[model samples]
Target: MKPFTESMLNQCRKYMFNFFDYLPTKYQASARDWQVRKFVWAFKDGKCAVSAAQLVAKKIREQFGTSASDMVFVCIPASSQRKNEIRYREFSEEVARLSGAVNGYSHITVEGERLAIHESKSGKHVNDVQVINFDKEFFKDKKVLVFDDVITRGYSYARFACHLESFGASVIGGMFLAKTLFV
Candidate 1:
């Protein structure tokens, strides 16, 4: 296991504190307890992240179609330098596992964005992963739920939804494994 940096520890603490404050009084302690459980479980094995992501995805799926065929599962890359966050390969893998278990998806597809920070000839370039391609045919006239490891400010999700919309896909919803307190 990588040593948790002082910065990382501090960030976790700060996030917990904020989450604590966000809860109603009755839920404050319960929320903290759950957070601790999640932290420990998530680090224990890759299953924790995947499990949580699956739950979120499942909820979205339930709302859209009685059948998984009514929806497509699309996720951002688990690792993105532009996001400066931990990579979630295990989480992504788990999501795939859960999706397979449910047995009715029209298809599961991943969203791809260029990693290079491109510099345009005019001196301005987009450097982050932009939703550029999807399984176009599979999603045609299908509802999609976009998944991510976390959502701090919701900008990433917004970008993804917009991209899907542009392509004439109906975005049924978005799901995140965890939402950090700080944007």
Candidate 2:
């Protein structure tokens, strides 16, 4: 596993458990790796995501065992425009189902203007307030494991965890398919 930078650790103060970083998005030569791209495509067509989820489940079971039962899996919702193009709910739900965890309620929504940030190299152009909004309910006193396709700067994960905590939910940790070596 890649070590968490001080910035990432700082942003994750609200979480009770260490964030799991499963894969690297690039190699030492700074090229996009096939595994990362294939994992992303798995959300749309390939079966790699299922395998990845199963691996994650195995890891969680080994580390936490029956304690995994209390955790609910949730994804960072894609923007409305992206949702029209690709259904991310399937990716997240499938992970939850395979992991044997409860899929938590999600009310996160993004604005249209923020969609461009996903195409940007660093994903630092978007701020917390401009990117997403959270529902006041749906996660009271629950334990959540937030999942996302990638982690560039970790802004989204930080904000999502904070929002969930504000609603009385305990953010156990976060999971991502890959971690980018970008700002």
Candidate 3:
């Protein structure tokens, strides 16, 4: 079922759009989910960020309609500058090019590495080790769409939205290729 607001956390009332519902690994994912997972792995490996982003861009264009033209799109940053460069930097660029949305990749810069919460055995929050720098004036009164390959729990989107808001940007929504289903 599609929920109107993607962030279950009430504090983050950002609008979010997801293209697919995917079952978690614990459960057998749907065929469509598996297809997306293949691309997600390829994207994470830096092998198909552009191609996969193109598909995402097409979907964004289809779903977002005219509103996308008014918003800037930023990808969720990887663990470090190096990883982000390998993954999302190029991905976001291609998405911007294909989707015709303003590229917000350069607007936010990340320094330092954080523990990968998805891979971690110990508990850690993404913001603890992340240093995100941006020109406050650039985001002032701007609308931003946060893009990610997938959303599991959405802590990242919520925190990132809060961060952008701190700098005066209105995080209008989030866009993800897929959202994981627990069952």
Candidate closest to the true structure, highest TM-score = 3
Q: Show pairs that collide, candidate 3.
A: none
Write out the backbone clash pairs for model 2: none
TM-score of 3: 0.80
User: Per-prediction TM-score, please?
Assistant: 0.49, 0.66, 0.80
Q: In model 1, which regions exceed 4 Å deviation?
A: 1-50, 65-67, 80-132
| Candidate 1 lDDT by residue in tens digits, 1-183 | 235444334323321101121221234446575775465336334446555656754654455434555555666543332231233445544544555322112233334444422123346555555443355566567666666555555555666565665567776556655555421
- After TM-score superposition, the amount by which residue 159's alpha carbon in candidate 2 deviates from its true location, in angstroms, is 1.0
Cα RMSD (angstroms) for every candidate in the order listed: 12.2, 5.8, 4.4
lDDT of 3 by residue, 106-170 (tens): 87788998886556645644555778777678778888888877787787777777777778787
* Local distance difference test, each candidate: 0.47, 0.61, 0.77
Best by lDDT: 3
